[model samples]
Target chain A: MIAAPDSPGLVGPVVLSMKMAHRTHGEGATAVHALRGVDLEVRLGELVAVMGPSGSGKSTLLNLAGGLDTPTQGTVTLAGAELSAMDPRARARVRRRSVGYVFQDFNLIPALTAAENVSLPRELDGVGTRPAREEALVAMAEIGIEDLADRFPDELSGGQQQRIAIARALVGPRRMVLADEPTGALDSAAGEDVMRVLRARVDRGAGGLLVTHEPRFAAWADRTVFLRDGMVVDTTGGASGPESLLAGGGRHRGDR
Target chain B: MSIRHGIIALLAEQDMHGYQLKVEFERRTGGTWPVNIGQIYTTVQRLVRDGLVLPAPGERSDDRADVERFTLTDAGRAQATVWWSTPVERGAPARDELAIKLALAVTAPGVDVRDVVQAQRTESMRALHDFTRLKAAQPQTDDLGADLAWSLVLDHLVFDAEAEVRWLDHVEARVARASLHPRPSPRPTDDPAAGGAGGGRARRRSGAPPPGGRRR
Candidate 1:
């Protein structure tokens, strides 16, 4: 773990921000720098897609954004609180209350029914069971899967399971969704369905940080960040990416 | 599908004049690929000559009859069925100028292949982003059956642009890896510029279209 000092900055309506964040694994001769000080922000109602070739730090960035991993240097702000400065207990509480995660696989519990799986996070945050279930239903209905709430994960199709997973990610007081290739396991049509649901949720004010290499899925985001050799190299639309700095002279991206 | 088949497919639904056919084709395909009125009339005249369609009810026989509604004959209907049933043949590679340009760049002098790749990638991503913005503006109402054609055509552009970007990335990686070591084979023995002709870099253009090259 790295020690974090609280720094003055206004993250504003942004749900997540990573300023000069670096994550290096191991040490000395074999140190692998997963991220080399990348700055990013996911504002409310914006879905930012991270796209790069293999080993370009897409997954590492997602982990740091969701507070699953701490940065080696720089601040990670989630919901206006600096994650790197928080103690483990406080960080976990913020992650449970403010952040929702969706992985490539559905990641639903096999034993629990869909409703229970969706409600589990709320329950873990100390909400009563009945209220948690009600929130779960609301999330499912938001994604148009209220009818499949009682079924177990194994019984549903991949697309249905993924929609349920998205509902779980959107449930309760969660203000941000961190999805790592949320459509990777499904076919093109089913993948479109997943992207649609994710985009709809983001449009309704839940910030999204989506990691995907597939350009079609990446298109669902408001902007895209391209990483190369553990650095931000280019960005398309709505991103003040590091590339503008790398290119020398800060030209307004709106003119690009 | 080719414009020929597209016209036939649309006509199978109902008889339409040339302007109507052009508008319908563009409408069905999201207006991404536009067809000129002259091209449509020329193709229709050829279809009539081949007995696949005929000018309806007291219209001129020449192709200048743009107002003449054309109806599909049985042969045209059969062609429409084939177009609908058969998957678009994609086994054979098309003539790609980008592939050719990149293939030349790795071997040419005075050209940074990476820059070439990166520039092309930026262009492709820009196109992909534009298509994505257009898609977001397009309505995706629940009656997808009516909107399926438009959506599919729009996605075709997005997917193709996406593939182009991926291919460029792959090319960049492979070129970076290969250029690490010098070529093992002997260099070309043409002596014109081999011995430092003119004591300056007198290399020919690395990536320029020569005379009579394909423009479009």
Candidate 2:
């Protein structure tokens, strides 16, 4: 997917962060063209929600944006580095140093204790055990789960396990986070707490992209993007507030 | 509106006992909707608790007994209006998860196509039988709403189940015919023979390779 091209010279450390412009996909008769064309720009300190129905390609867009999937044809750039142009090894390094992820299922190692699970990402990035454990503890403390660090996944309830996942995703050298259906499994009360934590992360200057089915979850984002049949159907909270843009009535802020 | 709102809406016109409310609601729905007696009682209890409804002048006082007669309050009438006026966003139309799973299951190596069709066919038949039995036992009432609404749902459920069964039979026949013909190598993506070979290339290109040469 990623083929690193020769670095284009003359731009001194371009800092606008990630940008994906006009991505398209399709093939022959059997080919279902998932994404028509999408343009997105993510700078620092922003939280965006991607909302759509089952087959609308929000996941496809997320995969492209997070370096989990590639565009059939388009440019994807992150931190002045062209993501679509990078070799596999170099792309891996970029992801390790720049991105974090929280999945709907929590994705914690079931056999490991909370601290051990939290430490796995840093360890994967080659950070040693002792220091990784210390970092993990701090991250767990931030998410209010420091007391549960010694518990295995089965010992904790769903909400606690998700908190541990959040800590794990945040404990490394990552500047951005991609959460796919992060609150989908939790009940309303627990989901609200998790959203609060994510909102705090964005307030602290790390950008986030959350893909979800629930309208209530989208209410928390700085901006919301709605997709339909693999196209960007609507955008809310750019220059106009969500009230005007989401007035079609499918979704609106909880504040209303 | 909550379930209480639903009950309150029904009561705004007059007082009703628990059984009367259940019968009336079903009648109004044209017997299409079967309201559980338990749900009717529960909603009545909640409405009483909220002061949306009050027991009639000479009704049973015991909480455990069925609400013999209950009348809606002014507040309850307002609540009913809110229920009627407010609009709710609908979730996506239901799709068959089983269908997607079965379609993908055919590409798995060592899976027999005939077995897949037979299993789905059997399941749909059982579901259709259950639906048929319920339709036979439907309450006989002249209530227009109850009569029309239930008939519509029953018709659709039967139609969908029968259609699925027919599709499964056609698929089984096609698979049997293809089995008799000379088989060609499957495409790397859709063919079971290609299995692990084409698995991770898309994921690989999407991002960097996983640690220790593992693909994510």
Candidate 3:
């Protein structure tokens, strides 16, 4: 159960923000602190990359941001709603309407066509099948892959499949796509192609939190957050985006 | 690297004077390589001396330093073709400052290697972030050639910096692991014929500190 206060509405151009979040797994001697108190924000029209060594809690921060997991301490505000205050059912509905997730693996249903896989979310939201397919096509075209709509996931290349997955991420009323190394299993060229699509889509007024180890891919984001020992150590770039150093974000440059 | 060949390649397209060659070279390399007009002329003069370059037929000047256009000779063209076909040589690895610095830091007494690595990591990541911003600031144009040529090494610098950070992370893990299990100090020699524990330790592994071995 989550406690609800006055719930200051999630404000400004920011789509997601986590304040003083701490995620510890276990208790007492066996406890493992996944995320020490930390703060991060991804504004609309921005792609923020999270980079860290293994065990640095990049995935845990992502899970909290997407409403898939609640932080042990702090609130995750998504789409003007406080996730910490929501019950599980309400949280699920909010996630469906507000966040789209593209995983490391393609995660496409083999039985579904590319269009169907993209339109499936819209259908789940109770839209008519024909209208959903049309919207799916429009989304696919936005990402420059409408030609691959009829083909199943198996029929497409790794890059093309990821673009379709991006189309799915772009389709519903989602505000952000929390892509977890979406370029996994892709070669450099194919990986760049996928980032190009993701960048264009996010440029079209959606937010993105990209988790990647590849600098070439992270170079595409507005800014990159570096984590170490469950704490944010430094952040780079995002000069043109909103000021995200509101809490625990350190812009360390030079010989700091 | 080869200013002579660069000038040849430039002139292969059209006859160009020293200043023009300098400008063209800068443009082709996205300004990453800035060449002085003097260097251009020096290289051009060398080419002309070697019979690989000649003044354009229509261009003439009273003073040798005046604006004289250069054109690649037949031999120059042939050399350019060969250069195009050949691969750039990567010789044996040269000494890198950071590599040397870290090597010394790990072994040097009274030095915290992890701190050094973190400092360098922050600096490297900052540079990478700057490179990324430089890349992102460029509004992609429809001209693919121009876009690709905008800053050929900008993305390369990004990749290099990223690699540096990854390498630093690796170094940190190795250092941390070493600290956790300090190499067992060699037992003091039982026989008086052998020297003290100091000699054995002197020959032991370098930078193997007893991490977390200090007790309350």
Tens digit of per-residue lDDT, candidate 2, span B2-83:
3455577789888898888988886764453456889988888888899888888777767746657988888888888888
Off by over 4 Å in 2: A1-26, A239-256, B1-216
So what's the TM-score on candidate 3?
0.81
lDDT of the candidates, in the order given: 0.80, 0.66, 0.79
Clashing pairs in 1: none
Looking at model 2, residue B179 earns an lDDT score of 66
lDDT of 3 at A250: 39
How much is B173 displaced in model 3, in angstroms? Answer: 2.5
TM-score of model 1 vs. true structure: 0.80
Q: Which one wins on DockQ? A: 3
Error of 3 at A85 (Å): 2.8
Give one digit per residue, the lDDT tens place, for model 2 in A21-58. 44455556767767777776665566677765566788
lDDT of 3 by residue, A148-193 (tens): 8889889889998888888898796887899999997799768877
Q: Which tens-of-lDDT digit does each residue in A158-248 have in candidate 1? A: 9999999888988998989999888889998889888888877777768989998787788777778988778888777553232322123
Instruction: Estimate candidate 2's alpha-carbon lDDT, on a 0 to 1 scale.
Output: 0.66
True contacts kept of each: 0.24, 0.00, 0.28
Tens-digit lDDT track of model 3 for B1-216: 667778888888898988889989988867656788989989998999999999998788868655898888899999889889998767654567789899778767779998898788766765565555556556554465755785455666666677777788778877887788776544444666657456544555655454433111
Full ranking by lDDT? 1, 3, 2
